[model samples]
Target chain A: MNTALCMLAAANPVGHVTDKPINGQWYVSNVTVMLVLSGIATLWLLIPAAKRITTGKSGSIDDLRTRGVLANMVESVCLYLRDEVFRPVLGDETDRYVPVLWSFFWFILISNLLGLVPILDITAALGLNDFHGTPVGIGGTATQSIWVTGTLAVIAFVFINGTAIIKDPIGFLKHLTAGAPVFMWPIMVPVELIGMIVKPVALALRLFANMTGGHIIVATLLGFVVSLSTALGGVSGHGLAIVPLIGTIVIYFLEIMVAFIQAYIFTFLTCLFLGQLVVHAHDDHEHDESHGGEHAAAH
Target chain B: MQAMRFHLALVYTALLAGPAAAAEGANPFVGTIYQAIAAAVVFVTVMVVLKKAAWGKILQGLQDRENRIKHDLDQAEASAKQAEKTLAEYQKLLANAQEEARSMMESCRADAKKVSAELKDQAQTEIDQARQRATEEIQWAKENAVNEVHAQAAELATNVAGKILRRQINAQDQQQFVNEALAELGKGLN
Candidate 1:
């Protein structure tokens, strides 16, 4: 099958049109659908949430029934960050950074799911096969695309450090040279700069590598069927074909879980970084002192 | 804090490699998508408006609930005070009823004693009148018996005088004596 036909075939699980590929580079595949769906879903969720936060009525009757789902889901995510994730690490400074973290979580999650579709699995599926024969959206995992993950990382990088600088300009700069004495400044400065840039970059790669590696492994495993077919001249390949098919089924479920997890990890790390910058070092010191005091009194 | 920072550095080091490799691609920086840029603008605008509105309304709701609780508490206290007053009044009424019953019993005993004394006096007076009438009847019977005895004595004395004249004189003298004697006896008896 041609690149366009393969993509169209993969994009629609049902075989719609068997012939006539679309002209030029304009194309929609499974990955594209996943991307569009995610974007729509995210917006659909955020609009009512924005309204509720502004109006503060729990909402009107229609709003309660219709827009309530997305609003409720966003609120739950926000609440989780505030109560469980942010408060534990960042302490009282949690509130200031929660919105940004919430945004990051949802944006990354939707995109990761977009990467998991089979239309994006082409290059990986055929084992480094020619791109000319593959469909547009059929081969590129969205999250695996360095551009996509890198963009997300960059946003996190700017927000976390930016908020920190705004909150405590001196402290934000000083955190770079924080570990040792005045003599260590020259060495620490370079390290801190690198550290600053590395935070988001690492965030991007973690997501990218995980998605890419999983896709490649599944594709390579599926290619075994073709190899066996060739080796046994067709008969033995058919006998062993069911094995790879069963394996593909199991991998599919694992990929779904990984998609959600990778999204969480991306969001989680971003929040942790923000927490480090925004929360005061003195508060943590006080907490330690109080804890020590209790321990001493107990003794 | 140092440990946390160190951990973050480790995490970032691992991730930086992915983006660096992707930087070698045909178009490393694709700028931003139109949808993403739009979403970011919407996010900033909505967040500012929502922050102000949410904080204000939530605080107001808390205040309203507080006022309602205070009003309910005041009403309960007033009702308790009124109930206490009613209880005190009932106790006073019960005490007054007991005192009146005691006084009425005392007066009833006094009036009963006075009535008993008047009845005894009236019965005594009637007994005295009955005894005087019985004594007067007995005295009249005794005086009538003495008058009957005096008339019998006068008749006996006249009889003795007639007998003495008969024995001493003749028949003719006797007859004349009898006549004179009868006249004298009758005049003496009368």
Candidate 2:
């Protein structure tokens, strides 16, 4: 087999890796599509939002009370980010970073949904046939790719520390060696670096593993039916044949649910990291406002 | 050094992964993906136009409608004030006319009574004058009639006396004596 065919054959059951090349460079196939779709969806969502905020014209109480397609969509997305993602870990710091976090939440959500669509799954299904040509709109779970999630995580990582550094240039370095002796600096510095780098890596892998794992399980189950049917001359060969079909269908639905959950998880962690970076536990008044004076009294 | 290590690790991973999956040829999705991109651009352009044109007019129309309603209310209020003033003036005029009519009626009643008294007095004077004139004429008529009666009575007596005398005398003697006596009597009376 040619190199391209060989590469596609080894791409696993999910269409994570494909033979499609852009400018002679082989990009991670699904990641490119996810990023594109996410950008477009973000712009589409933000237009009316920008208009609403800039104009200060709002829908009436009737509009808020009822659900039209556009209103419902905006409300649902905003509510999910606020209640589920931002409120939990961020707590007091939630407001400042809520917008960016919400954007990430929605973007990740749409990309995950796009990955599960049947048309995108065509290339993965007809693996051998895909050697002839790349299927239209072919992609798997975007969350599965390390580079995609890692890039997003790295951006969060930089902004978090960057802001903290900018806020208190002197105090920022002091926190790294906070309570340790002079001798521990050499060991502590490397440890802190690992700690910093590991956070984003963890964020990336957690999302990627969860998303990729679900798709792989569904694909493998479907692949079993295909192999069995070919061996036995037909799909309904043995009584055991019904087992694979039912299992595939069940796993397929489970995979879809997992997609949403993973997207939410990724966004929630991002809020947590941002909160840690920006929130200063030192502000007595702010602490009192947020935690009802408990943490302030303790301090 | 740490940042360098991170970049190196990323590059190493890329190099090791080798043209991912190393299979498949000719991707079919590439042909028409650009169309969606083009459509997105058009959609954004349309949004800009709508925001500028349609939204502006709608807001302006709402404000204009508010102003027009306010103007109409003001006009209605002015007209109502004018009507109230006219009504009050009419009421006052009616009152004045009623007073004038009342005065005129009172005067007419007084004039009628005075004129009736004057007519009664005039009629009384005319009746008195007529009665006096009638009484005077009756007295004068009575006096003239008595005088005429007396004159007739005298004429009768004289005639009778002459007849008696003629009867008593003889026929012949009487004729001669009568002539002589009448001549003597006529001369004496003349």
Per-residue lDDT of model 1, residues A112-228, tens digit only:
665555543453455542346543323344465554566667777888888899889998887777545989999989987887787777787787677766664465445444333
Candidate 1 residue runs with Cα over 4 Å from true position: A1-37, A48-75, A119-140, A226-235, A282-299, B1-190
Candidate 1 residue pairs in clash (backbone atoms < 3 Å): A119-A138, A120-A138, A202-B15, A202-B16
How accurately is candidate 1 docked according to DockQ? 0.02
Clashes of each: 4, 13
Model 2: per-residue Cα lDDT over B1-190, one tens digit each: 5455345333332332344323244221222333233223333333344345333432333234345568779999999999999999999999999999999999999999999999999999999989888888888887676545444443344446558665554556645655565555546656
Docking class of 1: incorrect
Alpha-carbon lDDT of model 2: 0.55
- In order, the candidates keep a fraction of the true contacts of 0.01, 0.01
**DockQ for each numbered candidate:** 0.02, 0.01
Instruction: Single out the weakest 10-residue window by summed lDDT for candidate 2 chain A.
Output: A290-299
In candidate 2, position A97 carries an lDDT of 55
Give the distance in Å from residue B92's predicted Cα in candidate 2 to where it truly belongs. Answer: 58
- Compute the lDDT for candidate 1: 0.55
